[model samples]
Target: YFFRDPERRPPDLPGAVVAPADGKIIDLSLVEAGPVHDSAARKVSIFMSPFNVHVNRIPVEGVVKALRYSPGKFAAAFQSKASLDNERQYVDFAGPYGRVGCVQIAGWLARRIVCHLRVGQAVHPGERYGMIRFGSRLDLYLPPECDIRVKLNDRVRAGETIVGVLHETK
Candidate 1:
């Protein structure tokens, strides 16, 4: 069954929600850990294979605040440097809960990262937002202090797995 199916069974737990892309978790870095503009984020990278699903979904319910499209060389997304050197689309969404960021990276031979939502658009958790036409990677950057539940290289189903618990700051 494909993700984003209207008839799909709903999840039974509470958290930020599952990942939005189909791939293996390649890296999890707790970058700058701390408030909004002053706060840092944890970067989780999912490497998509050509044989995996190419569509993406929203990991949490929120409203799109801004969209930044970066034009760069199309590199193999699984490579260590792809996250830095490849073309990418960065989207920032702010919910009543917190801020969440999504990054779509273009892989070798895959030149497009199509984001179909606009600024101010509201999105539901697990809702289809856009896709990387062929194969690429999706990075979910979360606020620091989030308690993650998934492991590196773990196989995850978009919309069906819980990757983290959106922690409440003390």
Candidate 2:
């Protein structure tokens, strides 16, 4: 169903950002942003209801640096600690302009996370990297310096929403 969207294609675009997964954005916070790729990083939590599309896409163009897979309990992903304790994958991407991160989490009822890209793999913007079977969540770790254009409780369409700007890295 998600493949039918023509805007989901990958290409170089100025100030063009896409959703990392198909779901509803439930929570947003201004946390301690990371360096470089995550300079002005704002943390966004996306809750994928069972009825929503399960496919996940890359928000920007970049190469995979490292994949951190941690095993944990299948708690609900809406909680704050769920991001720290849930079974998820930490994907780091390096791009020409900057770097970014994506966190795929398993919800209480969902238990599978399929990551299609490997370390050193070059993925384009809006490319399908993997999926979370059943209900799930995706966290976008953005640069702290980037301008957050969305708000909490806002419904964002994956592959079509511009969550934030990709600031030019020094």
Candidate 3:
């Protein structure tokens, strides 16, 4: 069940950003100049249980600028510190709205993260980019111009739910 790939249809509204993973929203916060991103961003975190689909998708259409993987400790997917302390992979993209960062974090049961993205590869929203074995977490660092759609504790489906709508910055 965890390996099944479901068909998803992304919203066509301009600037609409789709959820990258199927999970429950665990966090929504503002952050600045940390790790993969150097500008102000709003992080939308989702915690995936072992029963949920492990596949991950692109949140927006963009060109991958970099991919960074770090070996670290296993932690609970819902913990705030897990984003930093857990083994993870970060994908940085140069999007139409600017920079976007997606971090795939390993939880207690997840040890491997499979990523299909390469530096400079152009990706579209809803496209499968990777997967994490068992349970894990995904964090999307979005620009401040986003109008977020989901609230904390809300459940979202990868490549389908519109997590937010981004607006162009002046």
Top model number, TM-score? 3
Off by over 4 Å in 3: none
How far is 104's C-alpha from truth in model 3 (Å)?
0.3
Please write out the lDDT profile of model 3 over residues 26-73, one tens digit for every residue.
999998764556777899999999988889999988799999999999
In the predicted model 2, the residue pairs found to clash are 38-143, 39-144, 39-145, 40-143, 40-144, 40-145, 41-142, 41-143, 41-144
Model 1 gets an lDDT of: 0.77
Residue range 1-170, candidate 1, lDDT tens digits:
22233423326655565688877999888767311224688788898887778888888777998898889888789886887788989888777557878889998967878899899999887888888877789888887766788889998767767778785434
Per-candidate local distance difference test: 0.77, 0.77, 0.89
Clashes of 3: 0
Lowest lDDT 10-mer window, candidate 2? Answer: 2-11
User: What is the overall TM-score of model 1 with all chains considered together?
Assistant: 0.87
Ranking by TM-score: 3, 1, 2
Model 1 ranges with Cα > 4 A deviation: 1-10, 33-38, 168-170
Candidate 3 lDDT (Cα, 0 to 1): 0.89
Using lDDT as the measure, the top candidate is: 3
